[model samples]
Target: MSLVSAVQVRCPSCNTPFTAQMHRAIDATKEPRLKELLIQGRFNLAQCPQCGVQSALSAPFIYHDASKSLFYCFMPMNMGGSAIQQQQQIGQLTNQFVSSLPPEERKGYMLQPKLYLTMQSLIDDILAADGITKEHIEAIKQRAALLQDIAQSQSVEELERKVKESQDKIDDLFFQTLDDYIAQAQEENDLETAQGLSALRDEISLLTRPEGEIAQQAKQLAAEREEMLDKVINERDQERLRTLISEGRPLMDYSFFLALADRIETAQASGNEIEARRLTKLRDTVLAMIDEQDEAARQSLMQAAEFLRTVIREQNPEQYLRENADRIDDAFFAVLNANIIEAQRRKDENAMKALAAIGTVAASILEEKAPPEVRLLNRVMRTEPEQRRALLQEERALLDDRFVALVDQMISQLPEENADLAGELRQLRDMAIDVRAQG
Candidate 1:
């Protein structure tokens, strides 16, 4: 676990004083996600509740990756201190990290940590250790610059010409890089920049991909969805409708309700009074069903949260997790992740470690029980893009229609807020389909 503590910081936008959590040390082996957040420049970032302003707190921190034998300390130059004072701060951080480890785990390398004056330089070295060299990063930057030029095109002809000229540069990594920029902008509360980047991403996606292919596919999917919804809404059999509602619960989102309302309006506009009345009744029934489902989900999450608290109190969650394996469902994991995020928000190192341990155990259990195709899909999702093809090749037997359908199901079940994940799943789904077809 990392060392976390409370600190007071005033928001740059609103100048509102608020307590922010800061991490002084990070053990990459124990908390890999923290390392990722660090690389993304999101580490120790604080967001103001008053104005939604986000700023990274400039503080001294240590990073350690045991597997890589990589240890580095970061001390911001902005924090004015004498050379001796900086050394003392770094020494204290190093001591804390080394003392937290077991005697056997402590090595000579742990005693001497490399120091960095800036976070960006530290992040670059970290990426280099992960095999992402400076050239690769520079290439991504060039693509970003090209994307900016494309976005600033004076006319449709210029945009098209620029895109065609830089077709070689506009690869999957291009969109990914742009998405990173959008995420950074959004985090900093620069909505205009974020929105612009998003629009540019969409435009680039349309230009680089098969023309009208995505739109056509989306249209077909929507039509099929509409037909299914119509069938469910028009079904007069109470028993059949109940079964349909239960099965189609995932599709009963705000959009689904809005579509139903539109149908009711259309019926009224067409002077179909009886049909309108019937549609209204169906809408009411569906709304009630959704409310009931929401309540059940809320209750389930509450129970899961309480169960996690109990496990944390026990301090030995292995037994509890094993005994209550059946209860360690998606809801439980969702609660677990939420708890970890909240702990991260408050910089509660102990809570984060405990929740992470529980999550690891629960995930292993689930993986053990999952089908081979599911296991392969999980690995594919976790693997880097360039390496996934080889992984799929090794597990080609699992790349069947069933796996593709499973991916589709996941994509469909994801909430609208998880657009990024859904997009990734869609790409994975396409890749799996391609692999299966390669047979």
Candidate 2:
């Protein structure tokens, strides 16, 4: 069996003290026995055990022990004292109550009643005399006991269910009171007050409703937004695809060869041999049609042909020439020569006349009694300085024999006393021999 403690408590209505067990006091509820006693007010609640006269009990009369195992009733001092003094007195009384508990139970009870009583006294002060009825105090104590029992409940779900049931009963009562107030207002023709009260009631009802309905509403809204976003995205994609197809962007052409020639060239440069070969075959097929086309068709096909040829020329020059080098070179040179001739025809008359005069003088010199080589040399000498210098060296080499003979003759003609002229002739002859040897 559990150990229990009991304390004497005065009936608040009659000011008649009586013994009440702590468990019973904490557990007091709205039972028929309690109602018949009508101990629902600080005054006129407690019954006198002898005379049965109910009288008002003063504040600070209720007391609890340290372990909260006992509640006590006592006569309090007059209201002439300061609040601090009253608190001190109550604190001493609580200390005495705790000191009276057994040492084993006193350990957990350390100063709990003092704290509870202090807080309770402050609340009682706030409520003043009008609010602190016996019924209100009893209700608070009962709620505390119910909370304790809920703590011992097996599961959170069970505890939550019980709490909800209690809250729902209170809420129903509140709504009923609000409905009655609104009705009274309406009966008095106070339309404004009635409307205000109805609006307040609606707001309170909404606040108390379950959260699942709100969550479902949010989920529906999000799903609708997602659906609209998907539709817009799909429509935009379709429009983009259509525009690309209409503008000839080649989305349908999966053939790698249909790609731009520059792309093929780049692939070839990057050593993508397979892509390069495929592109080359496709380009050749396209270009082969040019040979079968008429002039107008060929002209219309200029871009495709040029692109194919450019890729081949830049990527594989040898192959390009093997295929169309002769034809392309002939066309290029013809245009080049035509441009040069046109420029020559536009030459100044004075420059032309100067060239003609030089040519005539050259022809007359070629008519001299010179070797054919010398004639050719003289003809070249008019315009070629390098050829003139070469011919002069050749002539000097051939005259070496004559130079030696003339030097010997001049040495003989010199007088025996005129040795300087003989020395000069000898020097000339030696220089000529050196030139011949070098040549």
Give the alpha carbon lDDT tens digit for every residue of 123-208 in model 1: 99998998999999888779878877888998767877898799899997888777667655543335457656776676677677
Alpha-carbon shift of residue 377 in model 1 (angstroms): 23
Over 4 Å off, model 1: 8-20, 47-54, 99-112, 138-223, 236-243, 249-266, 277-318, 321-330, 333-439
lDDT of candidates 1 onward, in order: 0.81, 0.45
**Candidate 2 per-residue C-alpha lDDT over 1-439 given as tens digits, one digit per residue, 9 for 90 to 100:** 1113455666655566675433112111212122112232232244468556654434443333232243443324454578787667656655654565566745543454423333335335323333566566655555545444544556546655655565644355456445545654543334456555665555345445677875675466456544432332234354453343333322212222233465578778999988777656644643443233323333433433343335334555434434543333322333223323322333324434433443343234334544554443334335354454344455664535554675577689887888975785575456556656766
- Per-model TM against the reference: 0.54, 0.18
Candidate number with greatest TM-score: 1
Residue range with the least summed lDDT across 10 consecutive positions in model 1: 183-192
Clashing pairs in 2: 13-45, 13-46, 13-55, 14-46, 14-55
